[model samples]
Target: MENINIKQSDGAASLAKVYAIANQKGGVGKTTTALTLGEALTREGKKVLVIDLDPHANASVHMSYFPETVTTSAHDLFFDDADFKSLWGKIVKKREWVGFDFVPASIRLSELEVDLKDRKNKGMVLSNSLDEVKEYYDYILIDCPPHVGVLLVNAIVAADIVLIPIQTDFLALYGIRLLFDTIKILNKVLPSPVKFRALPTMYDGRAGACRKILNLIRRKLGDKVFSTVIHMDTKFREACASGRIIFDVDPKTRGAQEYMQLAREIVRNENA
Candidate 1:
């Protein structure tokens, strides 16, 4: 894989570092990491925009925007040829509570595979679309779907970094090889291979199995594994139920603190 290079457009260089939070396996805390990291980045005084590409719309709902009510969403970027000005004005919604911009996901996104099946450059659609507004933010977080398909490809193609949240358990490593293989295949075609980091989530220090899995992850991936580990926290569920981020629910909690550390790590790495 090539050294990390942020995607640059034709005009002035884009300030945004796009991150795709993805994992082929479900229940791996992809949405949680996306939303929390977004909020955490905002707390660090960075402008963040989260693009919800998951058809389940978990990130959208947690941010208090329901897909059913929105007329335009991330789905429109895939199908419509609307100008950046129109799309930005219509699709991006500001969240006052978390202080980040968001593009909600629509249930209609589930149909995009068939809808754009015949299109030649379906994967490049998102990369092209994001370039229009990339200069406006410091970070753009894309919440990808669980399964691999057109939407996942679009997200990967558009991202500078792909964050994979791995649940620390006996089955933690299961099916992850498939995702690695997919990236390898993409690297054959991309100008630069997508950079990725594995974040261990839902960890319980009391559980020997969790510790063993986390150790195995670090042993297997070395520097690719993030130092920050998201411990199992019930507050995450409460925050989701209340339609707020962990920081709003309780900033002092481990869940909130760890995500903040993650944001700092990312920023520090960029500077390095």
Candidate 2:
């Protein structure tokens, strides 16, 4: 790992905390964390923008925005040769709830990796696009894909902080080394390298193996690991199935409370 620093630009419209929820390994609750944290932040009176960069568009589906119905999406943001401001206007879809907006992803994005693989400034596309409406958001959260590719690279490049949601399992940690290596390479090209924190998710306190993996992750990452751990709960899947935020489904549940704590922890980490 290399030393990373965050640079605050004066040109930013609002001091939005740009976070990319990324992990090379799938099934680690990346989308779940992104949506939950975004909603939690909104409850705290912060305006949040969630960008679904995954072609699967689970976050969008969870929010009830079907890909077939979405006219302008993240695919347009990346592939359409239009001015970012204009594209931003076209792509951003406001949620029924105030203070939350998102750029849904379409299956077309799966084809984008090959389309822009040869583009000179492909990695910077997302960063430039988000700058157009940065002032309107207090936090910009991107739900990245499960693999390292052009899309993932764009997300990492655009982010101020890369939040890795790791499940409390050995398999989830298997390929994280590759993710760190990718970050190190990308950071070398950035003026201010993006900082990262590994968050342990889907933890089951009763499972000895889960607890062991969490401890092992802490030992390996040390301070790079967040203090807040998201324990596994059935509420996450239930909330997603119901298309409601965990807070709305069951605010008093441990799952909801943990997500709220994670949101606060992120805010404090950013300020620190």
Instruction: For each candidate in the order shown, give its overall lDDT on alpha carbons.
Output: 0.87, 0.84
Clashes of each: 0, 1
- At residue 214, candidate 2 shows an lDDT of 94
Best by lDDT: 1
TM-score, each model?
Answer: 0.93, 0.91
lDDT of 2: 0.84
Candidate 2, 1-272: lDDT as tens digits: 11112233455555677999999888999999889999888887677889899999999898777989877788988766567766777677766643467778898999987898789999998888777777767899999998889899999988988999999998998768778989999879889877899999999999999999999999999999999999988998888888888887789999999988988887776668
Every model's Cα RMSD, please?
Answer: 5.6, 6.2
Cα distance off (Å), candidate 2, residue 178: 2.3
**lDDT tens per residue, model 1, 65-138:** 78778787899998776675566667888766776788899999999999999999989999998887888788
Q: Count backbone clashes in candidate 2.
A: 1
Q: What residue pairs clash in candidate 1, if any at all?
A: none
Superposed model 1: Cα runs more than 4 Å off: 1-14
